[model samples]
Target chain A: MLARLNVALLGLLASTLSFAGDAISATEKQPLNLHAIGMFVLFVSMTLGITYWAAGRTKSASDFYTAGGGITGFQNGLAIAGDYMSAATLLGLTALVYTKGVDGYIYMIAFFAGWPIILFLMAERLRNLGKFTFADITSYRLNQSKVRTMAAVSSLTVVCFYLVAQMVGAGQLIKLLFGLDYNIALFVVGALMMVYVTFGGMVATTWVQIIKACMLLAGGTLVAVLAMSQFGFSFEKMMGQAVSLHSLGEKLLFPGTLLPDPITALSLGLGLMFGTAGLPHILMRFFTVTNAKEARKSVLYASGFVAYFFNVILLMGFAAIIIVGQNPEFFEGGQIGGKIVGGGNMIAMHLAKAVGGNLLLGFLSAVAFATILAVVSGLALAGAAAISHDIYARVIRKGKATETEELRVSRFASVGLGLVAIVLGIAFEKMNVAFMVALAFGIAASANFPVLILSMYWKGLTTRGAVAGGYAGLVAAVLLVVFSKSVWVTVLGNAEALFPYDQPALFSMPLAFLITFIVSKLDNSAEAQAERAAFEDQYVRAQTGFGAAEASSH
Target chain B: MSTTASQNAVYARIRKNPRFAELVSKRQGFATLLSIIVLVIFYGFFMVVAFNPNLIGQRLSEGSYVTIGIAAELFMFIFFWVLTAVYVKRANGEFDEITAEIVRDASKEVK
Candidate 1:
């Protein structure tokens, strides 16, 4: 089945290439600056070196899984910031805000809302579980094999969607920022991410994330500060300038102003908010910290940093609107939007170039590249961990595995996953990367979030129920997204779409929750009782970190 | 059964720690409520502006609205930090105690 899927995917790619005309040719004319290329290389080399050094001491599975459970709150905090602040947040949100106005704030609201939920509900529990992946937590109370299967499926689904989005974004971003061909750009990014993950594992990924987070925040802050300085640091004057440009109105105060309708806006918001807690890459970060308390502190720090950085992004977006509106000709010939000029995503890059010149533009572009690298590496790690740790080592091997053997398997899996993502990136080169990101989030929220939430909170949740719920939500959401008008028209260039709903959460989420509950309730057996007891014990241990400490001490 | 008793005893010890006891009694509940309140207020303000455009429309240009929106966003961003600072101070003073008690109890089980 997997082989068949790959073959079909390749066919789709070949057809897309034939129709689109020379995928590689589009990238040949614009050679990237040596300085920007050098900066990217420097960052990647440093990250890889640091990660390799860290990996040397990782002799045990625990070390591989949770960085020996020694990560500080502040370091973990920065890592969390890195994990959350993907290219989607840095590039996509900034552009959306610039183009759409008020509807852009909806993304901020949805994204930040998930943090409180994480702090209050999941952080401590996840930290206490002390496993490398979320499957350890969800499967603790159910049949191990069944839970692992559900987890693998959910993790793989979310990771692949996320990976494709990041890679596509990378390809487009490289072309826009550095004027590189899409194929060359994708290949370069793919190679860099593979190097980072294969050598350093979590340590390299975390450090790179930290560095990228710092760069993104610093870059955003500098732009905001510069833009404000131009306005003499007077908020009112900036508003006046903006007002003069006719950029403010009812659209700035309402949800549906930018979107075509309220339902789609609400769906977008739902996906962003619910998707945060469900994403495999983000959830896996909690396991890297030492304990529940550290996890909580890390989230607290992340929330603080994320909120501040987003504010700067909002400022930059508005600055772009006012500045760009005043000088439309400045951005007239750039290949963005429909005419290949001044698309929303290019606002930040264009702003940097206009305000600060080549130096700033080059720096910001490097930061954007790093953002893609960090996020893709994390997603790849999650996919690798899910495959090697959960599916292979735990289920297939039945817990009989040597440390060296497991590590080798994980590294190999990382390479394989990276290859798959690169291939997918090449295939879907023309699709709007943001749409893929939204689909990934939607799938995560509908398919994974429901099962994860219920499994942890509800004692009656059975193994059968989890599997049923997970697969149902996963299949339904993917099918709905694939058949939606966005995919058919925007991605495949097909006018006719089979699915009526653009967002599947309104139906798929409830369907998942209902099926899981019903299935668990109908199951009655001694094994079920045992499963319930084990789950309850795990929850109790997780709340207190008793079982984890015991295992670690041994 | 004795092991379960010891675990319960550890829980009791955690409950007996004054910092833990106080945190459990008030701090977590308060932080959770405070976050909810802030979100409500923020969303409510948006609702008001969204429902009654006339109130915000007095300001000229979509750009002015964008400016105001950005300003509000900046304020909220700072506000989250203030909230975090307050939480951190309280957590260090109170929540840390509960956390310490739990860790202490877990350490005892390990030994």
Candidate 2:
């Protein structure tokens, strides 16, 4: 299985290598948006400088994977917030709220809820358990090779889907912001991400995320503040203006006006609450801190930042409706007769422009571009870790691979992952990328979250159970998502969806939990008993930070 | 109960320590409770969204522009963050010190 998978991956990589720097449709045909482009270039060059410095310092696998465990709690907080916000949360969520109104708040809250869950249950234990990748913790007491393989597959799947979603979002938003073609925007972002990961690794990725987080927070807050001042600093007056000025009127202020269905709402709740914890890129962050203590601190800081950011995002949504919605300059034709300029995703930028004018518009556009690059860099680094640290070093080499060899393979993996992201991003260019990101979160919730949480808490979990449960979840989520209304009916042009609902977690999450429980209960094998007996030690270590991987002092 | 480990067997001795039992129960119980509280808040709101969309969509008051849904979820969101801070503060202050003590006593006995 391992050899065959390796061959398949290598084949995929080889095919991609030829197309690495290929053309991205025709971008030059479009008129240049000088302000956005200039700011984007300025931001890119600054990040490139950081990447060069990080490249010189990144020496060992620890440095490549977890930034040598040297990240402070506050910095990790910013980076984690950076990873979570993405263009989807910033521009996409803003658009959703602008269009959907009250329904949008539910989605943002669900996204933020994952942080508290992580802090309460997973963060400290993961820091005390894993080394670089989350697979380290999951495979610790179970059958190492088997668990690693299972974890690597799930981790890669989550990262790849997340990568495509972020890339597609980057493409569409850049086109809107910069007047560039979709394909060109994707290609540029993908290439920039590849440079960051291939050159600077985790150290560079973390700093980029931190800087992006601060910028996003500052920009989001300013937009909200300016919008609020319009109504004499009264939220009620602002909301009144939002309802009255919005295309939908008072309906826009109501929840069901956008999301009327309860089933989809319940299912989406499942995806956001659990999926945020399961994302490999997010989970891998726990190891970047020195100990369980720092891990907790990081989550605390992250929770605060995420909550604050979302509060501002909620305000941005209403602001768009009140301020951006009223201004005829933002419409597609620069008048009220046409649709909002660049569709809904551009509303936040339009709001920035309306409140802050061209100078603020340039700054916000640059910040949004930085948002996409920072997120993709983090995703690529996680994918590389799964391939190199988990699959290559632990599984293929039987834990005997040299540090130099591992680091080299990791760089190659980063480039391979970046290329794949560009291709997938272009393919999904026209899709609603916010929905695509939701699907990614759903997959993580069902497949990875169950396995990781159970491994930590349940002594009954065995290799058979973990593998069976994980694969069951991975298959169910992928299948259900493909058949759901979003894909089957919408993307695939089917007359009707094979699945009744868009969110799969209502069915898939429970099924995963049930299967894992039943399988572990029935497995009476000697190895199963041993794995069960070994749980006490794993639990002790998870709780007390005993036998944890030491943070290297860089 | 030697200080030298026979592979995974080092932890087997600590398992018998009274302190070990106490630490595990306290920490696990605390985590379980925190998780349940969050789940209830999240899923409870979810239930409302799932079952009664109109309930949340209603205005906070007759004249207010803010909907009950917005007000309620915001309360829950801020509350959840507070709960996390509460858990982290307690664990780092109370739990970590207990963990260190438990590990120390268990190791001393084994040595």
CAPRI class of candidate 1: acceptable
Against the native complex, each candidate's DockQ, computed on alpha carbons, is 0.26, 0.58
- Any idea what lDDT model 2 has? 0.82
Cα error, residue A544 of model 2, in Å, equals: 0.4
Model 1, span A1-554: residue lDDT tens: 32343344345334433423443466323344555655765665566567667667566766665666777788989998998898778777777767765557656866776676677657777777647888887877677787887889888988998899889888888876666667767877787677777767787788889999999988888888888788887766765565456445335544445445445555655666678888999998888877766788898889988887877776787777676555644444642322314355777877777677777878888899999999998899888889888988888887787777888888899899889988999998866765667678888888888888887778888888888999998888888888887787777888788875577766677788999999989988787777776564555465556546322431
Indicate the residue-level lDDT of A173 in model 1: 80
TM-score of chain B of each: 0.58, 0.85
Error of 1 at A497 (Å): 4.7
Q: Please provide, for model 2 over A1-554, each residue's C-alpha lDDT reduced to its tens digit, 9 standing for 90 to 100.
A: 32343344345434433433342553322234567666766666667778888988899999999999988888898999998888878887898888888878888888888888788789999998889998888787888888889889988988988898888778777766766657766777877788889989999999999999988999898988987888788989888777777777777766663445777777888888898989999999889998888899899899899999888988888877878876788775667736876666788888898888987888898899899899899999999999999999988998899999999999999999989998888777767655567677877888889989999889899999998898898889989989987888788889998888777888888888889899989999999998998788788778788778887876
Model 1 bad stretches (over 4 Å) = A1-31, A246-257, A333-342, A492-501, A549-554, B1-93, B99-111
Best by TM-score: 2
Give the best candidate by DockQ: 2
Judging by lDDT against the true structure, name the best candidate: 2
Compared with the true structure, model 1 gives a TM-score of 0.86
Per-candidate Cα lDDT values, in order, are 0.72, 0.82
Model 2 ranges with Cα > 4 A deviation: A1-31, A334-337, A431-435, B1-10
